[model samples]
Each structure stands twice: as structure tokens, then as C-alpha cells.
Target chain A: EAGVTQFPSHSVIEKGQTVTLRCDPISGHDNLYWYRRVMGKEIKFLLHFVKESKQDESGMPNNRFLAERTGGTYSTLKVQPAELEDSGVYFCASSLTGRHSYEQYFGPGTRLTVT
Target chain B: AQSVTQPDIHITVSEGASLELRCNYSYGATPYLFWYVQSPGQGLQLLLKYFSGDTLVQGIKGFEAEFKRSQSSFNLRKPSVHWSDAAEYFCAVGLAYSGGGADGLTFGKGTHLIIQP
Candidate 1:
């Protein structure tokens, strides 16, 4: 089975511009997740989707960030009016189940650089 | 608040040597502990997890971890280190879901391992 794949391995945009990162999860996976790691910071969760429904989005840092999963097949994270602090690596992950014990497969991650 | 701490920022070990990466977590209840590895420019890969039962848990890529409730620690260990094992390792604590669900994890800053030839 193919693993999770992300688009635009690296993205560079000016501050205040908008950027969207896409993720295609493994086939038949029900759970999709988003996480990010800022420079010199730990990787932190952003949001989760369970079959097109936002299972949990508490990890979202601000209102400018939005994530959507359509048809539960793919997920997109859009950041509008991106700020300089938003520069970091964004990761997408998926799991067969939303249970606590299952392992989550991750993508290569999209490096976003907002200047 | 739940948090994870990886004491060593980086470690250097020789091939065929035993390796240990220390991890400490602070949570109110028993948490799901995990060990993940990430190569350069790659995503985090799950190595092992400890939910319940035996404290020792085996993972892919010849890795294992031991969970100590008393010390509030879950440490990753490998019997023999290989050159390919050089990567960034992170220790995370899964947030307990009240309704039998899963929540986002709290991860440590990560430790970079260097292999000595």
C-alpha cells in the first residue's frame, strides 16, 4: 500500500500571502491528521479528520489557519495572510483507525517558508 | 498540562554498541507512550508504543522501549546500533481520550543520534 504523500515538497511565499498544503493519505484510512514543527520547536499537532469530519481541531494555533478534508480521501490545510512565524515543516499523517493504539503513517512533509 | 521531555538533545554511539534514549512525561493518568524516528527531510515514523500490559514493547526497525510507571518514564533502547539508525528520535505521550477516543499527542523536542564508524 502506498504511504501518505504531500505536495510541493517545499513552498516559499511572502508574508500576507496565502498557501495551501495538500495531503493524500493511504488507501482505506479513516483518520487524517496535520502537524507542524517550527524552527527550534517540537512538532505539534494541528488538527484531525475522521472521514471528512473534523474530529479535533484544538491544536490549531489561530483563526488564519483552516483545514478541510473532502470525501475523507484527501486533506488540505490553508493558511491565509501567512505570517513570518508560520515558516516551518507541515506534516500529514493517517491511520487505519482512530483508536489510541494504532500506528499513524506520516508523509514527507511540506516545508513552508513565509518571508 | 501534559508535557514530554527528552533530556539529551544529541547522542553519539559507535556501531554494535547498546543505545538508550531517555524520555520523561508528566500526565495525570496512564498515557499511551510512543517512540518515533525521523530521517533527514522525512516524516516521523512510529517505532514503538506502550499502552498497557507488559512494560516492554517491541517496535519496527529492531527497536524497543520500556515504560516505568514509578519514574514516569518511557525510554527507547536498541541492542546494537547501526549506521542507518542515525536519525532524529522523538518521544510522545498520547492524550487520554475520555470517551474512548484518541486525542493529539504531546511530543518531546527530539534527540539526534550520531553513529560513530
Candidate 2:
């Protein structure tokens, strides 16, 4: 089975511009998640989805960030009017839903640079 | 709120030497512990996990971690390190979900391992 894959491994955009990062999870996985790691900081959770419905979004930093999972297949994270502080590595992960399925497989991560 | 701490920012070990990376966690309830490694230009890979039961857990790549409830620590260890073992290691704690799946995780800043030959 393929692990999670992210698009545009690296992205460079000007401040105030919008950017969207996509993630294609492993086949048949129902749990999808987004996390971000700023330079010199720990990786932090952004949101989670279970079959197209958001399971938790408390970790979202602000209103400018948006995430969606359509048809329970893939996920997208959009940052509108991106700011310089939004520059970081965004990671997408997926896992199966079951009693013993506690492992979450991660993607290579998209490195976003906002100048 | 739950948090994880990797005390060592970086560690250097000679090849074939024993290795131990310290990790400390603070959580209200029982948490699901995990260790992950990321090589240059590679994604994070799960090394091992601790949900319950045995305190010592073996993982891929000949790595192991000991969970100590008394100390609130989960330290990763390797008896003999190799040159390829150089990478960044992360320690995380996941919230327990009622449905049995692990929820979002709280991660440490990570430790960079430098293996010397």
C-alpha cells in the first residue's frame, strides 16, 4: 500500500497570497489529519477528518486557515492571505479506524515559504 | 493540555556505540506514546508505539523504547548505532479516543542524532 503523498513538495509565495496544499492518503483509510511545523518549533496538529466530516479542528491557529476532505478520499489545506509566519512544513497523515489501529502514517510534507 | 519534551536537542554517537534519547511527557490521562524518525528529505516514519502493557517496546530498525510511568518518560534506545542511524527523532503523545483510534498528537521539538564512524 502506498503511504500518504503531498503535492508541490516545496512552495514559495509572497505574503498576502493564497496557497493550497493537497494530500492523497492511502487507499481505504478513513482518518486524515494535517499538521504543521514551523522553523525551530515542534510539529502541531491542524485538523482531522473522518470520511469527509471533520472530527476535530481545535488546533487550527486562526480563521485564515481552512481544511477540507471531500468524498472521504483526499484532503486540502488552504491558507488565504498567507502571512510570513505561515511559512513552515505542512504534513498530512492517514490511518485506519479500528481498535488496534493507532499508528498514523505521515507524508513527506510540503515546505511553504511565504516572503 | 498535553505536551512532550525531548531533552536533547542533538546527540553525537560513534558507530556501534549504545544510544539513548530522552523523552518526557505531561498529560492528564493515560496517553498513547510514539517515536518517529525522519531522514533527510524523507517523511516521518513510526519507529515504535506504546499504548499499554509492556513497558519496553521494540521497533523497526533495531530500535526500542522503555516507558516508565513513574518518571513519565518514554526513552528510545539502540544497543549499537549505525552510520545510517543519523536522523531527527520525535516523541509524541496522543489523546485517547473513545472509539479506540488515537486522536491528534502532541509532539516534541525533536532530537537530531549524529552518528560518527
Candidate 3:
């Protein structure tokens, strides 16, 4: 089976511009999560989606960032009016279920650079 | 608040040597612990997890970790190190879904493992 896939492995955009990163989870996975690593920082959770429903979004930094998982299959994280500080790597992962014990499979991640 | 700490920022060991990476966590209740490895420009890969039972848990690539509740530590170990084992290892603590409803993982600043051929 193919693992989780992410598009545009790397992206570069100007400050105040918008960018959308996409992720396609593994087949039959019901739980999807978004995380990112800023420069010199640990990977931090952004949000989680369980079959098209937002389970937890506490880690989202601000309102300029939005994530959507339509049709419960793939997800897209859009950043509007992106700031220079938003440059980092964004990772997407999926799990077979939302249960606490299941392991999550991750994608290669998209590196976004805001100039 | 729940947090994870990886004491060593980096470690270098010769091939065929034993390796240990320390992890510490702070949470009110019994926390679910996990260890993940990431190669350069790659995504994180789950090595192993500790939920309940058997303090010693085996993971992929002959890696293992021991959970010690008394010390609030879960340290990853390997009997023999390989050149391919060079990567960044991260320790994370999973918070239970409760009244506070925190259902995500808190990760530690990873430890970069270096292998000398």
C-alpha cells in the first residue's frame, strides 16, 4: 500500500501571499493530523481531523491559518497573508483509527519558505 | 501541563556500540509515550510506543525503550548501533482525552544520533 503523500514537496512564497499545502492520507485511514516545525523548534500540532470533523485545533497559531478535509479523504492547509515567521516544514499523518494506541503514518512533509 | 524532555541534544557512537537516548515526561496521570525517528528531509516514523504492561517495548530496526514510572522517564536503547541509525530521535507524550479534552501529543526537542563507521 502506498504511504501518505504530500504535494509540492517544497514551496516558496512572498510575505503576505497565500499558499495551500495538500495531503492525501493512506487508504482506509480515519484520522488525519497536521503538524509543523519552525526553525529551531520542535514539531508542533496544528489540528486534527477525524472523518471530516475537526477533533482538536488548539495548536493552531492564529486565524490566518485554516485547514479543511473535504470528503473525509484528503486535507488542505491554507495560510493567508503568510508571514515570514511562517516558514517551516508542514507534515501530515494518518492513523487507522482515532484510538489512542494506533500508530500514525506520516508523509514526507512540505517545506514552506516565506520570503 | 504535559511536556517531554530529551536531555541530550546529540550523541555519537561507533558502529557495534550500545546506544541510549534518554527521554523524560511530566504529566498528572499515566501518559502514553512514543519514540519516533526522522531522517534528513523525511517525515517522522514511529519506532515504538508505551501504553501499558511490560516496561520494555521493542520497536522496528532492533530498537527498544524502557519506561520507568518512578523516574518519569522512557529511554530508547539499542544493543548495537549501525551507520544507518543516524537520525533525529524524538520522544513524545500523548495526553488522554478527558474533561480538559487535550487529545494530542506533546513532543520533546529531538536528539540527533550520529554513527561513526
Question: What fraction of the correct interface contacts does each predicted structure contain?
Answer: 0.63, 0.83, 0.48
| Prediction 2 global C-alpha lDDT | 0.93
Lowest lDDT sum, 10 consecutive residues, model 2 chain A, at A95-104
- Residue A33 of model 2 has an lDDT of 89
TM-score of each: 0.96, 0.98, 0.95
Q: Please give the lDDT score for candidate 3.
A: 0.90
The DockQ ranking, best first, is 2, 1, 3
Model 3, A1-115: lDDT tens per residue? 9999998899999999999999999988878889999977888989988879898899999999999999999999999999999999999988865353247788999999999
List of clashing residue pairs for candidate 1: none
Per-model CA lDDT versus the true structure = 0.90, 0.93, 0.90
Worst 10 residues of 3 chain B by lDDT: B95-104
Best by TM-score: 2
What is the fraction of true interface contacts found in candidate 3? 0.48
Across B38-116, the per-residue lDDT of candidate 3 in tens digits comes to 9998889999998899999999999999999999999999999999999999998876553223356788989999999
For candidate 1, lDDT tens digit of each residue in B1-117?
A: 899999999999999999999999998898889999999988889999987999999999899999999999999999999999999999998764554556677889999999999
Q: Tell the DockQ for candidate 3.
A: 0.49
Candidate 3 regions with alpha-carbon error over 4 angstroms = A98-101, B98-102
| Candidate numbers sorted by TM-score from highest down | 2, 1, 3
Give the deviation of candidate 3 from the true structure as CA RMSD. Answer: 1.9
Query: How much DockQ does model 1 earn?
Result: 0.63
Ranking by lDDT: 2, 1, 3
Candidate 2, residue B32: lDDT: 92
